[model samples]
Every structure is written in C-alpha cells, then in structure tokens.
Target: MAHQLPETTSAPTLFTHSHPQGIDPSNPHELSASLYNEDLAPTTRKGRTWNSYSIFTLWANDVHSLGNYAFAIGLFALGMSGWQILAALGIGAILLFALLNLSGFMGEKTGVPFPVMSRIAFGINGAQIPALLRGAVAIAWFGIQTFLASQVLSVMVIALAPGAASLQQTSFLGLDTLGWICFVTLWALQLVIVSYGMEMIRKYEAFAGPVILVTFLALAIWMLFESGFNVSMTTGESRSGLDMWVGIFGAAALWVSIYGTFVLNFCDFTRGASSKKAIVRGNFFGIPLNMLFFGAIVVVLTGTQFSINGAVISSPSDVVEAIPNTLLLVLASGALLILTIAVNLMANFVAPTYALTNLFPKKLNFRTAALISGVIGLVILPWNLYNSPEIINYFLGGLGALLGPLFGIIMADYWIVRRARINVMDLYRTNPEGTYYFTRGVNFRAVAALVISSVVALLLAFVPALHVVGPFAWFLGSGAGAIVYLLMAKRRIDLADIDGEAIAVTPKH
Candidate 1:
C-alpha cells in the first residue's frame, strides 16, 4: 500500500487522484525522516509569493549587466549589420523565452528548487553532484561579475576624484590598491544584502530594473544628439545577402549561448513564483521584449560611437569617461555602478546560495552558503580570469559542456521518461526501495549519459580539427544526453506507477 503524507500546515498542495484509496499509509517506503527536511521540501505556499512583476525584474536584473552589454557590442564584431544583429537577437530571445518557460513549469508546479527537482532523475544522492557543479559555476560567475562591478566603481571614483589615481600606484595580487578597495566594497555589499534573504534581493531587483532602463535610455539619447544623425549601422566591412544571413544565425547562436547557464537553473527563481502564468508572462516581457529594447539602445549607442570617434567603443565606462562634461560623466558612472550591483546580486549570488544549501541542508542555510560562495569567488581571482582570453574560453566552454547534458537529462526525465507525472514526495525519499533510488542513491544511466555527451561536446569545443561543431556545442551535448538516457532507461522506467501508486523498485546491486 502507498503512504499518505501527514496533513500539516507545511505540507505541499498535492494533486488529488480519482480514488483516494490509491494512496497507502502503511508502506515503509512512504516516508523517511532524513529526507523530509523543511529546507529541501516543496516551498510552502507562504513562500510562493513572487508575482509576474517580480519575475520580470529578475530577468531584467540578469540581462542588464556589463557582460551582457559587452556581449551586445561583440555581436557587431561578427560582421553583421545593425538590422541583421537585431533580427538574430530577436530570434534568440524568443527561443530563450520558450526554453525558460519549459524549464520553469516543473518548479512552478512542484514548488521545489532545481537541485531538489533534480532528485527525480539523478537519485537523491546523485543530485548533489550536479548541484555542486552548478554551484561552482555560479561562484565563478559571481567572482567575474563582482570584478566587473568593481571596475565600474573604480572608474567612477577616479573620474569623480582625480586624487584617487594615486591609489592605483600600489598593486596587490595583480590589482591595484584602488581596485582592491572597490572590489572588496562591492563584494561585501552584495553579501550583506543577500544575508537578509530572498525577499530583500527581490526588492533590490525590482527597484534596480527601472533605474537601469532609464540609465541606458538616457545614455542612448545623449549619444544620438552628440554624434549627429549620420550614424551608420554598418561597422567595418559588412556582409550582405547569404553571407549576412549566415552571420545572423551565428550571432543568434552566440546570443543563445550567453544564457546557457541560466537556462539550466532558472527554476531556482521560478519556484518562488505565485503561479505558472506569472512565470510565463514575466518571461515573455522580460526576455524577448527586454532584449529587443536593449539591443536597439546598444545599436544606436555603438553606431553613434563609430560615427563620432571613427571606432567602436563597447565599454559603457569608457564611453562615459570620453564625455567632456565632468558632471554628466560622474552621473552616468554612478548609474552604471548601481546597475552592476543589481546584476551581480540577482544573477550570480542567489542561485549558488540555494545550490550550496541543497548540498548540505542541515549544516548550511542560505545565508551561510552565500557566505561560503563569496569566499570561493575571491579565491578564484576573477579579475585575472576576466582579462585572460584563453582561461575565459576554457572555463566557459567547459562549463557549457557540463551544463548542457544536465539540462538534457532533467528535461528528458521529466517530459519523456516520467511523462510529466513526478511523484513529488518520492523526490525526497531516502529509502532503498524508493522509485528514485535507482542504485545505492545514484542513477548510473543518467551519469553515463552525462559523461558521454559532455566528453563529445568538450572535444568539439577544444579540439582544433573539430572546430566546425564548436558553435553548436550546447545543442549537441544536450541532444546527445537526452537521446542516450531515453534509449538506456526506456524499459526500466515505469511512468504509470508514479501517480499515487506503489511499485517495488529493486536496487541494482
């Protein structure tokens, strides 16, 4: 007989079955004390409070960062015209929106973070491996973003006070005294805000989103008037016809790859959403529309820079510093600093906190996990990583390869293997007989699939001769993993047994 969860204020809202007797309350496999902890369980209704606007603000905080701004500038360097770049961005944005919604749906319904949801496919213990991988990636990102924000702060400080240049004369760990001061200050500020918890982070994003939008708009308008109307979208030698179309597609792939990491872990945000409709609606407005608006601003600002300076200037700080008006420069720099802080906290800080918490729930809560992640971020010395192209390529490429398979495996298990009928309670089960406990708390099939796909994708990315497949690395890895897992586990998985039914799952010894 199946087991019924005890009715409690903290119990999640489960979908009712036609026959109430289908659930058995006498089974030993039904519940485990070690598994049903509050931190890893489905989020309580009280915690599911984020509305459409909050979700929108989350994406806004993610997209309006220095890295994204720089990436937008880099797209023009791909030999595409302004119109072509815009088209590519639009297409990529739509694809990303759909992907995020698909990934978010499970979290919305189950009210569990990505790491907890991962248990369904990877087994309870196996989930920790992916969680750690994701947490490590988030830490690297946190470090890089922190360094980027600090650079913006440092620039603003030097711009406002000329005397600050003296501080740059002394160097430590490859960064000057002024750089260290700004980095530590920004890093500590993010830690403090995150320590207050998720609600405070949401509030920060909500306020920062509009300010960032206005700041970019103001900068774009200023550049337009300053640079005159003779702006040309074509920078350098531009391709047209078939060549331009190819470039557009390439640009689109690049755009999609930028959010590859977030695509895998977006459920961390959506789990807090009030409803599925809220997440879908928020993603629509936040992703494609926001990207379109930001792309237009970037194009105009970049075109104006080319027209005035006879060269492309993608760095907002550099652009601001070039302004002859000191007051305007200072104001713009301050706005950029605020934008950076918002992005760093929303995009880089929160996900890892949850990931680390999931890893060791009893010992590490969200605040402690965040503090640990922050310490590792400093150890990575991201300022150096940001400057070194070879290191950045290897690190990001390796991460993409790793994350792609994980995305594929989870989506395949949920949508195909389980046919969207996840036994939410089973996700937390620690019993050897639990459906998710494939073999000693690990799913070897999924791990094998992840390894095989990641190896192929990494080879494509790093091998000089196989460079032709480099652009499609994310798709290749994800598709390979999904197909492999489906083929291997098709007969072993029993979907009908998921909905309030008890089935003996023999452990593979």
Candidate 2:
C-alpha cells in the first residue's frame, strides 16, 4: 500500500518510491476513469516539466502588462505619494507571496491541479463548485485583460487617421466603434496563442518579459526627458490630507485583489513544477522585486505624462501612441500584443481550461475547453466593467470574496486538518466509501463555511458603509472560513497511509 511522493513532499519512509506496490500507468493508478484525465492527473516524475526559469518568466510576463501598468499607476488617483505607493506595493508583495506559496503547496506536494486538490477539502463531487466559480471569474478576467491590451491598439487605430478618433462618439455595448474593433482584434490574437498550447505560450512569455521591460524603461526615460525629470506623485483629482492617507491604504489592498483569479488556481501552474524550490525561487524573483521596480517605473512614467499633458492617463497605450511615427506605433502595437497575450495565456486562459476539463472530463479535453473559454471572452463586456481604478478593485474584490473562502477552506483542510497529506487516488475514485467521500461525496462543513464566509465577504465589498473594509475582502473571507471550518470539524485527521503523486498518466478511459 506504499505511495510515492514528490521530491519536496513531506512524507514518511513508509510511502517511499521503492515499495513493492509499483503504480501501473496502464491502469493509471486505478483512478475512477470519470474523475481522471491526462489534464487532471497528478504529474508524473518525468512529466514535471517546468523549472525555476519557467516560473520566473510566468510571473515576469504577467507583471509587465498593460493592465498592470494601469494598475500600478492607478493608485495615484487616490492621492498617494510615491513613497506611499511604494508602501502599498510592499504590502501587496508580502501578501501575494504568502498567498501564492500557501495556495501552491498542495499542487507542488501532490502535482494535482486545483480541481483535484479541491477534492481533498470539498469531497469528490463537491469539488465542481469552486471549479465552476473559478472558470466564470477567469472568463471575466480574460475579457478585461483583452480590453486593456486593446487600448494600445485603439490608440493605434485612432492615430491611423483623423476620422478614427470620432469612433469614440459612437458607442455599442458600452464600447466605442474603435474599441470594439480593437477588442475583437486582440481577442482573436490571444485565441491563436492559446490554441497553440503551453509551449508556444512559454516562448511568448519569455519574449514578452524582456520586451515590456525594455519598452517601458525606454518610454519612462523619454517621458522623464520630456518633463525635465520633474516627477509628481498624486494625480489631478486626488483626495486631500488625512483622507488621502486612508485612500492610499485602501488602494494598496487592490494589489492582492488583482491576483484573486490565480490564487484559487495556483495549482494549475505549480502542478507542472520540478519541485517546490523551483517555484519558490521563481516566485521570489518574479513577484516582489519585479513589481517594485516595474511599478516604480510605470508610476514615474504616469507622473511625467500627467505633468506634460495636464491630465491623468491611466493606460500606457496612450503615452506610447502620442508619438506620430507610424513605424514606432507599429512596433509598440506588436509589443503590447505580446504582453497582453502572454498574460492572458498564463493567468486567465490556463486555469479555466483546467476548470472546464475537470467539470466534463469524460466529454471534454484541453483544446475543446480552451476554445469554449476563448469564446466566453468574446461575449463579456469588459469595457463597461473595468471603467476606472475603483471599479477594477471592486470587480476583483468581489471575485476575491468567493475565492477567498475557497482558499481558506482548501489551505486549512490540507495543511491544518490533513497535515499536508492527501489521498491522491481517492480524489478520483467515484465510490461513496472513498476517503474523501464525506456525506454524499460532499463536505457539508466546507460548504457551510464557504456560504457563510462568502456572504460576509460579499457584503463587505458591496455595502456602501463598508467601502473602506471592502478592499480586505480576501482576508476577511479567508479568516472567517478557516475559523468556521476548524470549529465544525471535530474528527482529528490521522495521517496514515496517505497517497501522493504515486500515480502516473495515460489516455483517459
């Protein structure tokens, strides 16, 4: 009954790889064929493909994006000084580091994606809830990011001819004529990239990280030279005095909220890592320092542009498009396309693809699920949803509200309740008697915790009186759920004869 464990997985010698009971990939760990697919299975030792560099590039590519540039400088409108903005970035970095590491642990230790990991906490059948929720949230994010990327192209479109700027006057479905065209154009480009699979996405990410970094730096330098290096911090419509300090902290919470979608599905990426060390090393380089430097540069660019234009510019595309040179505009358009696609693939596309596959594993595969997800992007009206800084935070904060409780339950169940051990085989087993087969194959305690915490969390974000508290929706949901789950589950989780990544892969049944 021995089960193999991943290299970084903490387990006893009783479950060593040299056990007489070797896993049979032919039968494929005897997982219920219904719950198992190539995409849903625990990564085999050799199948663990990503390295530290892969992790580095994944975060680097996402951080250096059009939405993020807008996100970083967006705090300026809330009346924060450069130093206060840096403080917000610092707070966000620490919060995000903990969030990614904790959320990614079960994935690293077991090499199972988020849906499978959910079975550990929510019971086999109940796992579908979070998967569906994450899928919906991801589709919304896909559209939002696509819309942001389209800004760069929209700028290009308007500059192509004098008549193009008039397209803004004609609105359809909340977006102007040029906006709709650019949104669909970038939307098509990202689908092409996502259709190619993870390898091509990886290549795109490696290229994008450097292009955005170099391009943004060059743009920043140009802006600095234009304004004689006089960098201002607060924007035109900033809050005054003590109110400004309050808004700064509130805006800082957005940094964590922005990551709400991926936090629930961090496992989707870490499941492919060679080891936890590789992921940690990559995250260390990719997140905190990268955000600090990249955010600072973008903030400076925004400040310089404001000083020159005498107005606030949220998106970087406008600044890049100000130049009348057709060739530079073309080059910048290509770079933004790369940046947007890279982020969409890694952040928005990958997680939902797995979520959808997990839902209909028997009838669906990766590409089919991905194509459906891409189409979902086309229908979403992101132009209206993501109108301003406050709006984006509110949008993501609501997502964090639901995902936060899920995060709490999953982390608490895995680390505290199960002591970081999971029965990987049972996760896929359809039998009612499986280890994870709580009452009717659904953990009511977890469901109760999710409902209660989500209600309180949602109220915090949506209520007019608690607007200041809304930014901490993720924290509130996570803490409330963790507390409730621990109180409700009285049976001590005995860590005996647990399974890990002893399973391997084969074609689905």
Candidate 3:
C-alpha cells in the first residue's frame, strides 16, 4: 500500500513510506494500524474507486434499515395526503444530497476518516472530543440497530414455529425470553463480522445491498397489483400549500439530522477512496438517487398496505407478517431478517468501532471498542427502551442537538475559514500555534457554541410552545451553532491567513 504525505513546497503530497521498527514486514492490505497512532495510514490501491452504482449500493445498505421503514410510515400519520408525503420525501432528499456533497468533499480531498480529518478543524487533541462524541453516538446507535435487527430475527423465529410466539408473552428486563436470545444472537453475529474489519463489512454490504433492492421492488410490485395502483388510505399531513412546505422542510431536515452524525465522519470512508472522482460519484448515486428510489418504493408499499389492510405497516416484519401464504411469509421474513442484520452491521456497528478506537487508541483498539459498545447495548436493552416513538424521539432528538452544533462548528472552520488548506504535520503537534490546538486539547469556543446551541434546540424540541418546530430541532441547533461560531471566531482567528507551513497537520486516528 502507498501512503501520501502532506504537500511540500506546492507539490501535492508524494507517496512515501519507510517501515516502522519492531513490526513484521507484512502486506499493506494485511497490516492494521494502531488504534490512535498516526504513523499507520490507509494503503493506496488500484481500482478501489467506487463507481456510481457502488455508491447507490451504499445507500441501499443505509436506507433499508428498520428505522427507515418506520420513519416512512410515520409520515402518513402526519395528516398530509400521499402526494404531500411524496413531496416531503423528495425535498428532504435534496437537502440531504447537498449536505453529503459538502461534507464528503473533505474526505475525498484528504483520503482520511472523519476522526482523522477532525485534526484539521478541531486540532489533533481537540479532535478527540468530536471523535468521542461521534463514536459514542455511533455506539448507542449500534446497540439500537442491533436491537432492531433482533426484532426481525424474533419475528422470523416465531413465524417458523407458532408455538414459539408464546415467548413474546414472557418479559424479562423489558424484553421477552425470545427477545433477549435474539438480541444477543444478533449482537454476537455483528461482533464477529465487525471483528473481521471494514473489508468484510464492505463485501457483505455490496451483496446485501443488491439483494434488498430486488426484494423491496418485488414486494412493492406485489402490493400495488394486489391493492390496486390508485388505492387511497388515510389522509396524510400537509394538505395546504404552507403546510406542505413545512412538511417538506421537516422531512428534509429529518433526513439531514438522521445522517448528521455520519456527515461529520463521512471523510472516514472517503479518505480511503481512490480519488476525488470516486468520492463525488459515490455520493451522487448513494445519497440522492438511492434515497429517492428507495423512498418511492417505501411509500408505494406502505401506502398499499394501508389501503388494503386499513392500517399503516412500516417495519419489514409487519410487511412480511401481512403475507397470507405461509411459505412466502417465511421466505420474505427470512430475507428481511438478513437484510436488517446486514444494514445494522454496516451502518450502525462498524462506525462505532472506528469512533471508539479513535478515542482510546492505545487502550481501546477497534476490537475492544466494538466489544465495549456491544456490552453496554446489551445492558441498556435498547429493544425495550425503544417501545414507542416518543422514546425514539427523545433519543434521536438529544443526539441531534449535540451533533448539529459539532457539525456546524467543524464545517464553518474547515470550508469557510481554512479555505481547504491544511498543514498535515501540525495536526500532531501540541504547540499552541498549531491550527487545531486551542487550549488544553479542546476548543472551548466550539464546545461552548455546541452546548449553547444544543440546549436551545433541545428546549424547542420538548417545550409545547416550540412544538411547531419540534421536528427541526437538528437544523436549528446546527444552523445556530454555525452562525454563532462564524461570528465569534471571525475576528479572533483569521482562518484563511494561517500559514500553511507553520501549522503541521497530522493524519487522524
């Protein structure tokens, strides 16, 4: 594997390598870097650039989650019509597309993961806070996603044996006996795959992504034909023009917030990208096109279910449960179960591993991070914690507040202030003059903005008077944080004038 060092005297970073002592001379592909050590970097490889289709596959993995399904159906209950929901979906996706483009550029340019990239804006030491925050969030979500995957597993098991359905009646620590077993099983399975590392995750995602697409299309077609194309169900939200716009914005903001955590770290994966061309191509196919197509199928199938069954069905398990033919039901449930697990591992599980590994590189390596997260998730029993949307709303909202400000401050610093230039060596130095170093390995300015903005948004989310903008909690927090940081930092730190040579930039963990 080839490694590119930061530029020297206007030359683009040149590929340079001298092996470290005390390590076996191993193949680049096989060598794993120290958790927090900056010396080990991703190897450059040929033909690793993902094309547009591959990007679409990534979205397929991201969008096919149980949480996504529930979100789609939840739109119907918002009091709008079908068309309004479609509009919201479309508009929201567009916003998300733009956001992905913005955040992804740094990744493509730097070829580093999110945590590493943070060294540019947050300083090497300051970067750890955001890394930990992002990683911690991923950890929580990893557990939640595992719980969701397990639900589908339980559904499949119970479907296979009607007698086993009785397990649902018995409760232990908020989950039933079957729930505990399935949760642990899925938890363990993810641990194994994630333990194998990113390569295995990529391979599993590539295949599972295509399979889920085919399955979803088939299910949509079957529903439309059976329920009739023109069938109508419940009246959705946003019937009026103004209301529709609100819903559209809300929907778009929701998509942005849902992905806000990853948006900060998208560079993590993109840093490994073969080139800037690959990163752009991937985002185009993955974020916009993929989300729209998936959203369309989701709406169609969910709508059909409502029209035919007189109730909205969201979870793929619910969709499978609706199948009349027992054989078909079994097959569909099994497929969905597999799909859920794949997405859970890729989107939810793998990310936290990277995040936690970054936080305690020497002590908690990637494997250790994954293990700790799994244990905590098992203890929380997120399955039981997520019994209702209110719970989901609370959890998601709290995260949204924190992530929004962190994202805002980072983006403002990087693109607007730094103008995209960085000193790779300075990133590692603890000198106060380093571009990222603030005071005490932490950026009090950014942290203060984050805390203040998050509190305001959180209040708006919970207070009745602010319910009108309840769904936009993330947008408010991020937007406010960015604006505040920009104004506050403008005079104190001229982001553009920082001498590129004076500030050494290091690779992220």
Among all candidates shown, the one with the greatest TM-score: 1
Local distance difference test, each candidate: 0.76, 0.75, 0.66
RMSD, every candidate, angstroms: 5.9, 5.5, 5.9
Which candidate, 2 or 3, would have the higher lDDT against the true structure? 2
Best by lDDT: 1
Cα deviation at 124, candidate 2, in Å, is: 0.9
Error of 1 at 126 (Å): 0.7
Give the TM-score ranking, best first. 1, 2, 3
Please, what are the lDDT tens digits per residue for candidate 2 over residues 1-509? 01221132332343223213654434433456567766677777666667778877888888777777777776766556677778778778878887888877667778788888888888888998888788777788888888877877776666667688988899887888888888888887877776666556666777778887787788788889989998877664456677766666666677787787777788887877788898788888888888788778867887887787767677777777785678787787777777787888888888788788888887666777788898877776777767766756676656657888888888888888887767676787666657787888899889998998888888877889997687777777778888888888646654553544455542121
Which pairs of residues collide in model 2? Answer: none
Ten residues in sequence with the least summed lDDT for candidate 2 = 1-10
Report the lDDT of model 3 for residue 484: 80
Q: What TM-score against the true fold does each predicted structure earn?
A: 0.89, 0.85, 0.84
Misplaced by over 4 Å in model 3 are 1-35, 38-51, 166-171, 233-238, 388-396, 431-433, 490-509
